[model samples]
Target: MDLETLLSFEWGIMMPEFIILGVATVMTLLDLFMPKGLKRKILGWIGFAGILAAIVSLIGLLDYPVTTILFDTFRLDSFAKAFKLILLVGAALVMLLAISYEPKEGLTEYRSEFFYLFLTALLGAMIVTSSGDLITLYVGLELLSLSSYILAGLRKENRRSNEAAMKYVVNGSISTAITLFGVSYVYGLTGTTNIAAMREILLALNDSQSVYLLVISFLMIFVGLSFKIAAAPFHMWAPDVYEGAPTPVTAFLSVVSKIAGFVLLVRVMLSIFANAVTDGPNSTSILLTMEDTIAFIAGVTMVVGNVVALQQKNMKRLFAYSSIAHAGYILVAIASLSLFMFDSLWFYLIAYLFMNLGAFAIIQTLTEKSDSEDSSHFSGLYTRAPILAVAMAVMILSLAGIPGTAGFIGKLNIITGALVREQANYVLVSVMIATTVISYVFYFGIMVQMFFRKAKVKDPIKIPVGTGIVIGVCAVATVLLGIFPNIAFDFLQAQFYEFGDFLR
Candidate 1:
């Protein structure tokens, strides 16, 4: 912690995190001093620019050597660079949507607060992405979780919003406790908070009882982090939270927040648990022994999310369940541990970013127009706003994993990776396929409401320029990535190159 030690470490590699922290601080000051009469949406523009700068800064650091700072509390490597890129890009888009968002009440008075809160949350996610120490990881996790609790209840005037906020905070607190309990066990076992060091110590241990303790810690951590990802048995909070939160915040949760959970998963599971010696017959590592358990969780999550979604009439709840199912698909990649695991996980998250955000933007536009969250609002949308309806169809189809879309390509890679593995996960793969088909019933139901149902209102819904831009960009990207997935895969391989230094 000495100045000499700090000065010796290259600070240039941390520019991305520094930029985000600085932006959040600066915007908080602006929100305080700026005149009440002036437009505050300018904060959104600043946030967007700041996030783009972070992206550029991160790209510059991809060539920098992987290094840890401040007693290994912070680290820079290919894993951080690649995932931080997604976080920044996704935040930038969500910022635009936030600028365009027009909530019914209360939020207008606190418009500027919204922008800085989001940046702070993004900062937390970035911290988790780079953290090498368990304490640093927990701090970042709470930063994101606590900020999300506030964002979920931004509408002071709405009853449902308040209820959603209460539920979110309670569930979040429980999850945090569970995660810390696991971390404490890890510290007791290895006498260190640094994960890389723990890995070295864990590999040397041959005690079966100690390995069982590690497995218990793994389950505790998995159950806790599952709430972050909206995975099943812990996903009940999502439907209510997503239903009540503002549209832009919902998009942030579905894409950016969800991706950050997976980041933590890879960090904790792979770094500390994946390589831990099981010292059992034919089992080289704890992760190998736990694959079947992971697959079971994945299967149940996919089933619960897709099956429950079939009955949801509210748009946000439906998408919440959809997000859960998507998480299950990515978990399949994690469980199978195929050579293509990184490719499948990273690419699916990218595709999910575009596909989910685009759909939410459109949903926001429509629901705000009709003052409803019911599926019926989409009825006769094609006749009222043909272009908007068509774009929505594309997003929904992508979510359903239909061919000729990014979702399809993302799903294909996961299945291919699963089947091509040393021991194919045919059972989990079957679950993925079956649940995806079940999802189609509701996905196409929305399409039917758009194209086949009669219009409830006669006036054509006008789209704002900001929302229009989001829809257009996401739609085109979804299609292009589907046909030319190599564009993403190539950039991914260039930046991460198989995530070798990731677990280190």
Candidate 2:
């Protein structure tokens, strides 16, 4: 802890995190001093610029050697670099959405706080990606969770918003407790909190008792963290939260928050359990031993998500279920434990970002138009706003996994990865295909409302500059990535190869 020793450690690898922290702090101070009458939307613009800077900083660190600092609690590796890029880009888009949002009740009073809270949440996600120790990961998770809880309830006068916040806090606290209890078991068994050191210890242990302890701990951790990703049995809070939160916050949670959860899940499961062996006569890695269990959950998640979505009249609630189903799809890739697991997961996440956010942008516009989020809001959308209507169609098609869209390509990659495994996950893959078909019924229901129904009002929807930018970027990315998927795949493969033995 001496100054000289601390100074000797390489800190340059932390530039992105430092930039996010600086931005959040500066925005908080600005919010405190700014005149009450001044437009708070400018803070969102500044936050967006800060995210751009952080993205640039991250790009610069890609060439640096993988390094851990602060007594091995933080590490910069390929996984962290790649995932952090997603977090930054995703946050920037959400910031734009925040800037454009103009609710009927007017969120002007709390706009500045919303902007900075997003930065804090982004910082938390970045921290989770780079963390190399269990304690650091837990801190990052709570930081993100706490900020999100407040964000969900930002509409001060809305009873639904307040209720959403309450549910989130209660569920989040329980999940945190469960995760910590699991971590305690791990620390007790391995006598270390560092992921790498624990891996070595778990690999060396061969006793049946140790194996049983590891299994119990893994179950505890997985169940708790599943709440973060909105995986089934733990997904009850998502629809209500999504419907109640501000549109921008909903988009942020669906994309950035979900990505962070997956990053943490992949990090913990692969780092701690990848080398731990089972207790049977024909011993296997803990991940492989638990594959069936994970697959079962994945199957149920997809079925419940899609089937329940069929009954939803509210747009936000429908998308909430859709998000849950997508999580299940990605989990199949994780369960397969394929060599290209990260590749499949990353590509799908990127696709999800563009398609889902684009859909939300349109949803926000439509819902605000009529002050209702019902399916009727989309009726005769094509006649009222043809261009925006087309954009909505593209996003909906992509979500339904139609060919010539990013979601389709992403699903193809995931299915291919699963089938290529030595022991193919036929059951999980079959379930995914069936559920996807079921999903189309609800997805197309919106389409039918858009194209065939009559509008309650004849006025065209006006798209703001910020909102237009998001929709344009997302639509373009979706089509381009679909047509030439190899662009992203090539980059992912190169990075994976460069990283050399992930989670070792």
Candidate 3:
């Protein structure tokens, strides 16, 4: 903690965080002091550039050895660096969507706030990925959560937006308190806030009471953090929030925010809980004992998400349910505890990011044009805008896990992960397969609206420049990743090498 020691720590590895912080700060000042009549659309472009810059800086750190600073509160490692790239890329696309977004009410006031708020949120997500201590992770989580709550309600004139904000904050506060309570228990038992130290200390613990406390702490933290990923039991907030929030923000929550939650879960469970040995003749990790709990939650989430989605006529609500189901799929990978856990997660997230965001872009375009959220609004899209319809179809195909798409490949990896596990897990795999089939009912309904139904209007849908770029990039990436997944796997393996540095 001494000034000399602090100054001696190599700081170059943190360039990405520093860049994001600096950009958000400067943008905040610009938003306040600028002329009232000056258009703020340029601020979105500025934020996009800043994200790209941060990505470049993050890539620079890939070759560097794992480094810890601020008393091991911040870490620069392969895991952090790899996931940070996804965050930066995903956030950058979101900024583009915001720039292209045209609200029905003509969003004029607080235009600049929208851009910078997302930047700050992106900053928080980056911090969460790199955090090495419990306190640091929670701070990062709160920063992201608070920003999102405001972003959800940014449409001050819309009553739905306001309501969404209220519900989000209330739910978020409860979850935060629960997660912190669990963290307190861990710190009380291990007498350290650092995750590395907690792991080492927990490994030495074999008493029944201590092991029981570890189980309680894991469950408390698991339930608390499940809110972040929109998993079942904590997922009631997602449909309403997604329905009311801006389209770009909805996509960000479903992808970027959800991924960050998983990172937090992995950081905690795989660290301390993986080491706690239960008392008695046969030693078992605490995490293994909780596998059924995780699997059960995952199964319920998939069924609830897919089954409810069938009844939703609103596009956003359907996607919200879709988001919930996807979270369940990821959790199945985690509970399996297979050797491919990290690979499955990374590939699946990448696949979801492209397909989900692209789908949202099309949904926003179609809904804004029709001024309706009903799935019927997409009727006969192909007749009016052939290219846009095809793009949307690609996204949907990937989302439904159709063959020869990225989603299918991702799901294959996940199912394979379950099958290859050391112990029994056939029941969870069966649940996943059944839920995926049920999801097709709604997923293909959109396709029906797009390709088979008659047009509600004859006019061609106009695609914005920014939105066009996002759709094209996401669609192409989705198809390419599906066809040649090894390209992505090579990068992950080359950079991370099984995430070994995570514990060391």
Candidate 3 residue lDDT tens string, 1-504: 688997998899889988988888888898889899999988888888988999888888888888998888899887888788888899988899999998897679988989999988888888899999998898899899999999999989988888888989999999989988888888999999999988899888889898888888999999999988999989999998998888898988999999899988987888778888899999899999899999999999999999999999999999999999999999999999998888998899999999999999988887764445899888999889989889999999999999878999999999999999778599999999999999999999999999999998887678899999999999999999989999999999887764858787
- Please, what is the whole-model Cα lDDT of each candidate in the order they appear? 0.89, 0.90, 0.90
Clashing residue pairs for model 3: none
- Which stretches in model 1 have alpha-carbon errors above 4 Å? 280-283, 369-371
Q: What TM-score, over all chains together, does every model reach?
A: 0.98, 0.98, 0.98
- List candidate 2 segments past 4 Å from native: 496-502
TM-score-better candidate, 1 vs 3: 3
Ranking by TM-score: 3, 2, 1
lDDT over C-alpha atoms for residue 489 of model 2:
84
Query: Which 10-residue span in candidate 2 carries the lowest summed lDDT?
Result: 495-504
Candidate 3, residue 395: the lDDT equals 95
lDDT, candidate 2, 1-504, per-residue tens:
899998998889988988989988998999999999899988889999999999999988877767889988999888999899999989998999999998888887898989999999999999999999999998999899999999999999888889989999998888889888888888999999999899989987868999888899999999999999999989999999999899999999999999999999999999888889987689889888888988888898999999999999999999999999999998988888887788888899999999999999999988864456998999999899988889999999999999999999999988999999888888889999999999999999999999999988887688888889999999999999989999888887665455434465
Superposed Cα deviation of residue 322, candidate 1 (Å): 0.8
Q: Write the per-residue lDDT of candidate 1 for residues 149-257, one digit (tens) a residue.
A: 9998888888888988999999999988998888887889999999888989998875888888988888899889998898898998999999988889999999999
Cα error of candidate 3 at position 495, Å: 1.6
